[model samples]
Target: MASNRPAPQGVYVPNDDDFGGYDDDSSWEEWNPTEESIRPVRGRHRVHKRGGGGLARSSTVLGVGVIAAVGAGGMATAQGGKPPVAIEMPDVSAVTDSLPEAKSLPGVGALISDGSDDSAAAGQNVAVAAAPLSAAGVSTTDAEQGTTDAGEALRARIMEQAENQQDQADDAVQKAAEEAAVKEAAAQAAAKQTAAEKKIAAEKAAAKKKAEAERLAKLAKSYTLPVASYTLTGTFGQPGSMWSSGYHTGLDFAAPTGTPIKAVHSGTIKEAGWAGAYGYRTVLELDDGTEVWFCHQSSMNVSAGQKVTTGETIGRVGATGNVTGAHLHMEVHPGGDATGVDPAAWLRGKGQSL
Candidate 1:
């Protein structure tokens, strides 16, 4: 027995195994239309019928019209017949009115190449014109490295020079300080020496003044003697057997040998020598025409006619006479006269006690 039924609308039908479904609804799963359900296309997709059956025939005609219109719109967009490319406006700031002409860019010939072997030669020429970018033909990377090395060397030189200059300045300062110190020391030493010399001169002056004052004082109180003490031991004409000048011409003194005899006055020694029986006698003459005789000395100290200062030693006392004991005989002569004043009285008149 065979059962027959009407197929469902939009149902799939088999074509072959490769084209498994005739309706292909699986390929259009999102949206699908059947000839029974689809409406005729129109407007942007519209078409007019020449001659057709009914709605099916009209739907196919409308679909053809819609497809033709969409194809025409797409073709126009792809054609070069569209609006010209819009020109870009120029920026005023980028204008070159203020700048000089720029040099040609290197490798620019390559960009304008006509695909010939000569293009390489033109590019090389542009590169030669751009050689000023580097100091030598070497690349910038190598040049920059050399420049860095040179900069470091220059920095080292500058530092060395600075150090040398600093050393010189320090040496000059030290020398100046040393010279100043030496000068100051010399000045101080000179000042001290001058002060010491002044002090010594002042001391010498004071000593000289003191000596002069003492000399003047001695002169004011000075006196003269009439007879030396060594010459007279006894009075005028005393009785004694030790008479040297015949019965003691003057007087005798018994003194030790070598006792000093002094001048009686500031006079001259008139005679000084040995006398008969009055050995080693000395005579001193005065400005008043008076003469004093001393006898019996051990030695005479002054020469005859020599100037004798007052109280100066003329001889030594002794007993060198025609006598028994050592003694001196003294005599005074007024103008060499045999008759003379008493030696004792003459000593008193001259402010001396015999």
Candidate 2:
């Protein structure tokens, strides 16, 4: 089958010097006879008998043809003493077209050129045919397989790159999620701390308020009303023609004629048995330099500068000291001033309701 393929064309030139033999019939010789005459000479070449068996004289041209065929494809090969492996034939024209011009082939191109336009066709047919054999190392089978491997390699690289990118994306998302969770945990801790601080502050404020209330209750116990079992007949600042002042300056407590009047709080009795419009008045001065005036009393029991305890009976209630009815008119002077404040409001400051 390899022989059925055409030999590579124009690869070598014919020359008389290539074949060493006589061409004319005059150089022919007659036959041999004895075995000693046919024995091979020791120091000389073993000359083989040549006849019409093959083109033995054209062996040089035929060797060039085999080399060309090897270059052009379809050269069978033997491996490991096995039968010769059949080689696939490629298009000789395709292989030749890829090679350099016959003029470029080593040693063959110059011999093919005879310096005449008539030999141009032979020059064109000869070529640098060895390019396919040496550069490619094999026929189209290896080349086709190489192309397929290159494609698969490129695809594998693309897939690897895609997988790497996906891994990167997943890592980024996980990092973001972890950071968000940390932030959320920090925010929750801050909120709980704030709530605890607020609760502590509220508790402190409530405790302070309860302690103040207890102090005020104890202080209220230290005070007492000047007279009990009495009715409030007139309030402070009552406008009427009942006294010297145009407006009433004290509170009036209406009681029976012989009702006992008491000291409002622990204080020194400043003055008693007052004259003029105050008929039987008693003045009590407290520790804070505030004076309490109990007016319109029937009689007095304490004198000036006498220390008296709170709620002590000082005098009896009667119609005295510019009084319209039997009542006790009480007035208060803070820091011992002549102008008095409302006695009802002053008692209320001691936690007493009028």
Measured against the true structure, the TM-scores of the candidates, in listed sequence, are 0.34, 0.46
Q: Spell out the clash pairs found in candidate 1.
A: 45-66, 319-326, 319-327
**Residue 143 in model 2: lDDT:** 53
**Tens digit of per-residue lDDT, candidate 2, span 268-349:** 9989987668779899999999999888888999999899998899998989767778988889999999899998988877
| Tens digits of per-residue lDDT for model 1, 1-354 | 222223344534444343222222232123354564344454565445445556777799877765675566532121323322222468777777755434345555433434457866668755665545334444455456564344454555578799999999999999999999999999999999999989988888888877755654454234344233444557776665655443445655666777677777778888988887777789888888789998888888889889987788788877776656777667788897876567766665565544
RMSD of each: 26.4, 24.4
Candidate 2: deviation at residue 353, Å? 4.5
User: Best by TM-score, which number?
Assistant: 2
Please give the lDDT score at residue 45 for candidate 1: 51
The clash numbers for all candidates, in the given order, read 3, 3
